[model samples]
Target chain A: MATALNKPDRTLDQRGLLCPLPVINTNKAIQELKPGQILEVLATDPGSKPDFDAWSKSRGHKILSVSQEQGPPKVFRFFIQRSG
Target chain B: MVLATEQLQEAAKQGFKKKLVIVVSKGTIDMLYPAFVLATTAPAMGIEVDLYFTFWGLRVLTKKGVKSAKIGAVGNPGIPMPNLMGVLPGMTAMTTKMMKKRIEKYWPSVPDMIKMIKESGGRIHACSPTMGFMGVDEKDLIPEVDDIVGASTFLGWASDPEAITLFI
Candidate 1:
């Protein structure tokens, strides 16, 4: 199984959950990150795109990029920075 | 000089240790989850938490239509609606009702989340504007509200030099 990201301190693999799960779990992931550091989230939900955007806005984090990969799992990779 | 570096690191860590509090200004059902979940979990991670409910957001703190809170495309970004469904007049209402069922199925009740948040030591606030606009007395509000305050009260919480504030 591909775990998606190999990061220094923060990586969340949320593949099987639906709707709010990806957003909720990502919220938890961001609170642990350092101010300048980034959190990488790998999700399978297409809904993850807007959900993460709303979450990032309300949680005061930055969504640096959301990359869609071509594969069976339909990976949605999010690079988020903890905002001030 | 190694001791100096260690001391500097400690100070930097301390400076970044301020607690964050957030306010939820909207109460559409889909919007409520992000606020309640984040506020409840904040204290679990050792950060102080506060949630101020105002307007429709107050519905979560009141009994009139708490379970009916839902999202639509007028401005809600969270709904996964297709374009055809969005243009219909009753679409938001229909979508909201459908979402209500899903929320009831998938998550805890709003009242329960409020209880959990309080039990977990997070603070809840109701906006005075909403109360005034809706003609709601404190008794009309769910008992979990720590106080009835303006959004400015939460802004004050968020405004500290070291603190972070978010709107959900």
Candidate 2:
């Protein structure tokens, strides 16, 4: 139940997309949320880790956490908060 | 003096919003993809992007060119085939088809990328001299082109201290 408290305001699924799409879509998706809202992104692009990190830093967004699942198709989960 | 130094530090912390100016001079499929990719991606990252298409690159902005753009295997060192083999009649077409297939599997088409760039507020500038040289009329260009400008105008934009300029 503790995890339920951290539910993001919006979730963007960028699975199967490649470099730049993940970051580009994230930028578009985040604009739909209010400042301080959290966006949960599910991306399969291995490059998303660094790309998202750099994108968030440049735009003044706060990346709360990131985790990766090791699978045949590895998935990266990022919880980013839109800065006020 | 201390106040001025503190203000300068604050400005640095805030960071300057840089513009991205990409000059695209080639019309091949391989060359155009990277140029459009960066042009689209930079705007998404909150950077203002201006794409200057000149010389052969101006063809890419034409309605006909976007549909007929092909990759040349003959002179491209990246192609695995020998130069002689690459000159075979269908080699360029085959190579172009193969490259498009590989690219489409994980990426958006060039047209779609251009749309994304425009939607994200990126500007596309066509070189006026190239337009005349290539006989590309304004009606021949895709609607996405924001302006038909000259070298001096593009250079002025690229001269911004906070601008990142690239020639592709």
lDDT value for candidate 2? Answer: 0.85
Q: For candidate 1, give the lDDT of residue B34.
A: 80
Docking class of 2: acceptable
Q: Give the TM-score of candidate 2.
A: 0.91
Least well predicted 10-residue stretch by lDDT in candidate 1 chain A = A1-10
| Candidate 2 ranges with C-alpha deviation above 4 Å | A1-6, B1-16
Please give the C-alpha DockQ score of model 1. 0.05
Positional deviation of residue A78's Cα in model 1 after best superposition, in angstroms = 23
The runs of at least 3 residues in candidate 1 whose Cα sits more than 4 Å from the true structure, single-residue gaps closed, are A1-84, B1-17, B73-90, B101-106
Q: Of the true contacts between chains A and B, what fraction does model 2 have? A: 0.47
Question: Whose TM-score is greatest here?
Answer: 2
- Evaluated at residue B80, the lDDT of candidate 1 is 78
Quote each prediction's TM-score: 0.56, 0.91
lDDT of 1 by residue, B62-98 (tens): 7665545667756555567666668779888887777
